[model samples]
Target: MTDYNAPLRDMRFVLHDVFQGPALWARLPALAERVDADTADAILEEAAKITGQLIAPLSRNGDEQGVRFEAGQISTPDGFRESWHTYREGGWVGLGGNPDYDGMGMPKMLGVLFEEMMYAADSSFSLYSALSAGSCLAIDAHASEALKAAYLPKLYSGQWAGTMCLTEPHAGTDLGLIRTRAEPQADGSYQISGSKIFITGGEQDLTENIVHLVLAKLPDAPAGAKGISLFLVPKFLPEADGSLGARNGAHCGSIEHKMGIKASATCVMNFDAATGFLVGEPNKGLAAMFTMMNYERLSIGIQGIGCAEASYQNAARYANERLQSRAASGAQAQQRIADPIIAHGDVRRMLLTMRSLTEGGRAFATYVGQQLDLARYAEDAGEREHAQRLVALLTPVAKAFFTDNGLESCVLGQQVFGGHGYIREWGQEQLVRDVRIAQIYEGTNGIQALDLLGRKVVADGGQGLAAFAAEIRAFAVDAPVHREALLEALVRLENTTRWLLAGVASDANLISATAVEYLHLFGLTAYAYMWARMAAVAQAKLAEDAEFCGAKLACAAFFFERILPRGLALEASVRAGSSSLYGMEAGQF
Candidate 1:
């Protein structure tokens, strides 16, 4: 891979110029004292340094070495443990954690850029801390004050790490079908007994202990998902004095030899009567877990962006450097025997697609981060509710669309390398492997699509869409460059949403059948809006910084003319309905 570099200028543009994140921070009372533009810039710079220098150097070695399982202990790849310690000391893990608990208290808008940098540097390395940050959010939001006091500081400080254990060998998507048992103890802690498979960071040697936020059904619990409860199960139980005590029942049976992210341990956790504390209320675990899951969903989406970005940097560099066939019209590099691949039209298409998707994804991820900050930190209840609604509607889309597009971007990057891309030497293949899991984990892309189509859109009768469309229209009025195109796209989205809502009542399978396309349609529109906002900023400031802003305007034009048209096609596919899907019987094949 071309030495991984963080797109700092692009990140700054999206955060400060496109979204005015610094100004937003100034407005939020909680962040007003904690963070400023300088703080964010310094953090981004520091992140770019360590991630590129320390973490990135280990990525290739990590994947090559992978994680080792001997007896019952799990050991990470070479350099990983040391790197974890370095990251821990820097207070990078809790960049977005609550300040009350020793976290840096950075907003998601800035935290996300750091996240992108880490993932870009090393997917496996980023995941270890990603889970820790996410679990801290869940604990801070739902756990009792006592529980938070016990775990929050250590987790935030990176003295300890965390994991979410929900999937079992028998259960993957359907939490309702999980057979894990949580038995109450006379001392108040429950005995968590179950086998949770595909548990990321379930077992690792980097930290003194591992905190697992588990989901299980109590004996007195009702049937189905609503009956489940959340529990805090640590590998090493803490003493009253706030130090490690006896080892808990959580154990890693074995680690998966996965397709990608080999350095990050994906374990099969066996919780054998582990001592656990209840979080939130009885039979209300799903809601608590969602606090972490939703956070992870967005983080995972950024994984896609990061992977695609790393791939693009290498691909773009290779395209400009490697000379093969002459240009279509004639030889551009007369000095060389043949022209560089970048001179070809097809090569330009691939490179531009990678740039457009990667950059647009960065913008989209930041926009979502803006909403998250508004929802959590806004003082006004109305603003908070509006932000929360947008979060609810957009979270799944962020997870699904970013990842799906992330994979495509990575593939295009690989394709740009041609035969060289297929080889491990180029590092493009590794990225392709690493990025594939983003689509499957946290929640599968299909599940996310269904959530968007069914829960967020249809369940509300498109009221959420209507609210969101109004906001888009309001922005479009100011973004004169792509105003009409954005407005037209918004109308198409509203009409398509109405179309989905129009038929859900009559067709039981409508959501499942067209959910993916519907989400892409929404995602395409979202990106178009994002590009329009970007283009608007780039348009007015052309003379101030022609290279950066001009490129933004050009890319926005490319997105509007080329990529945005896919929304119409997605709408058509959604309207195609479930009839074609149902006709294929199981035995017909």
Candidate 2:
């Protein structure tokens, strides 16, 4: 694998040039005093250094060594524990956390970029801290002030790690089916008893304690999702003085040997009457867990982007250096027997597809981060509501589309490597294995598509989509290039959304059948818009920096010409309805 370099240039281009993140930060009162352009740049630089140096070197070793499970304790791969401490010391875990409790208070717009970098450098190592940040968000949002005071600082400091335990052997997406039981105690704490499977960072030797935000049903609670309750269960119970106390009942029964992210300890956690404190309210656990789940959904999406990026970097490097067949036009390298494979049209096509999709995914994710920042920190109520609506509508799309595209990008990167890509030692195949889970976990891509079409679009009558189209149109007006393409794509997205909304009423199975395609239509259009915005910025700055800006223009053009056309096919499939899907009976197969 080629040494990973954090794409700081592209990231800066997206943040400062395309998104104008610094100006946005200056406007938000919550971020005005906390961050600036120089600060963000410095943070990104520091993050790039650590991720590229400290964390990245461990990725190959982590994958090769994986995790060792002996008896009940789980030990991470070599260098992982020390790297975790180094990461913790850098205050990165709290980059976007609540400042009231010692977090760095960076905006999501910036934090998401850092996340992308970390995942790119080392996905397994990144998982340990990623879950902690998400749990911190959930705890800060729903837990009591006392609980926040107790856990947030330590969580932010990385002195402790956190995990969300929602999935069980019998339940995955269906939270209502979870059989975990939480019985009330005399002093208000409860006894959490059950097993939660596929818990990331569930059992690791990196931290002093592990904080598990668990979901369970109370005895007197209602059935299904309504009956669930959120609880804070720690491996080591904390004393009143903010130090470790007695060991709680939570234990790692065993760790799963996963397809990828092997170094990440995916555990079957057995909470045997563990002492736990209730979070939020009884029968409202699903609502509260979403606080963390949604955060994780987006983070998982970034995992795809990160892996795709790493794959592209290695593939691109290999393409340029690995000499093979001669160029069709002529022998580009006269001194060598054959020119580099990168000279071939098919090779260039593969490389461009990876480049366009990965860069566009970065831009799209940054846009979502901007919306998140606006939702939480915008001054006007109208602005906040608008941003929240867009966030709601796009969160699933971001999760599903980015990941689906991430897998595609990674595959293309691997394809660029031809035979070498299939080899494990090259690291291209590892990226494919690692990124596959992004589509499955944190709510499967199919589930995300259904959520987007049924819940976000149809339930709201496409109000959020309409607002999103309006934003696209507004951008199209100012976009120096690709304006017409952006506008046309916007119309197509709006029309496809309307068609989905209309068909869902008449056909019960229509939404689920076409949800995936509908999401792609939306995602393609979103990327087109992102490309247009990027092209506008790049065009304006062309004279100052011709080479960089010119490349941006070329990428945008490639996206518009080659990539955006996929939306047309997705639209056609959406219009085909559920008839074809229903024709296949279970017994017929």
* Cα lDDT computed for each candidate against the true fold: 0.93, 0.92
- The TM-scores, one per candidate, come to 0.99, 0.99
Question: What C-alpha lDDT does candidate 1 achieve relative to the native structure?
Answer: 0.93
> What is the C-alpha lDDT profile of model 1 across 141-256, one tens digit per residue?
99999999999999999999999999987788899889889999999999999999999999999999999999999999999899999999999999988899999999999989
Steric clash count of candidate 2: 0
Alpha-carbon runs more than 4 Å astray in model 2: none
- For model 1, the stretches where C-alpha displacement exceeds 4 angstroms are none
Q: What is the lDDT of candidate 2?
A: 0.92
**What lDDT score is found at residue 520 in candidate 1?**
94
Q: In candidate 2, which residue pairs clash?
A: none
User: What would the per-residue lDDT of candidate 2 be over residues 1-589, giving only the tens digit for each residue?
Assistant: 6789999999999999989999999999899999999999999999999999898898888999999999999999999998889889999999999999999999999988999999899889999999999999999999998899999999999999999999998899888999999999999999999999999999999999999999999999898998999999999999999999999999999999989999999999999999999999889989999989999999999998998899889989999999998899999999998999999999888888888988999998999999999999999999999999998899998999889988998899899888989988788888898899999999999999999988998998988888998888777776789988888888898888878777787899999899999989989988898888888889999999999999999988988999999988998999999899878789998
Residue-level error in angstroms, candidate 1, position 371: 0.7
Model 1: lDDT of residue 554: 84
